[model samples]
Target: MIRGIRGASTIAYDNPELVMQETKNLMERIIRDNEVLPENVASVIISTTADIVSAFPAKAVRSLPKWEYVPVMCTHEMNVPNGLPLCIRVLVHVNTTVPQNEIKHIYLNEAVKLRPDLTK
Candidate 1:
């Protein structure tokens, strides 16, 4: 079976270092928590708030050891008048036997507020 795990993170500012760091942080948490192997990953879709333009979060995912071949794409999230700013979101599609309810969706930093219901 295949499942898509969702995650999001936020940076204090639009810096390349922050983008790379937080994006990698979020992905690592998802991978470790789900016990997902890079080989089982299909694709990852990443989006950042329009206010962020310093770097592509996909670059961070690609930099992960053993994840060089995972397909990843990056884009800007839709701009809403009162939407959260400086946020990065990701959807990772991977082959897994785990049930949907058991999957861990990571939301870090300020992005945690976006999905309070999913938190423990």
Candidate 2:
């Protein structure tokens, strides 16, 4: 079965360094928490709030060792009047046997507010 692992993180500033760093951090945490191998990943979809334009977060995923071949796409999240700012969100689609409820979704920094119910 294929499952989607969701995660989100907020950047302190709109810079290439912060965007890539925070995204890589979030991706690493997701892999560790879910026990997923880079080979098992199908694709990664990343989106940022309108305020974020300094970099493409997908570059961070490719920078990871063994993650160079993973398919990744980046886009801007729907611009909502009340949407959170400086936020990066990811949906990792992977081939996994684990049940949906068993999967852990991660939220970091201000992005944690996006999914309060998933926080520990």
- C-alpha local distance difference test of each model: 0.95, 0.95
> Per-residue alpha-carbon lDDT of model 1 for 18-91, expressed as tens digits?
99999999999999999999999999999999999999899999999999899999999999998989999999
- Residue 12 in model 1: lDDT: 98
Count: clashes, candidate 1: 0
Q: Write the residue-wise lDDT of candidate 2 on 9-61 in tens digits.
A: 99988999999999999999999999989899999999999999999999999
- In model 1, the clashing pairs are none
Candidate 1 global Cα RMSD: 0.6
Model 2, C-alpha of 70: deviation from truth (Å): 0.4
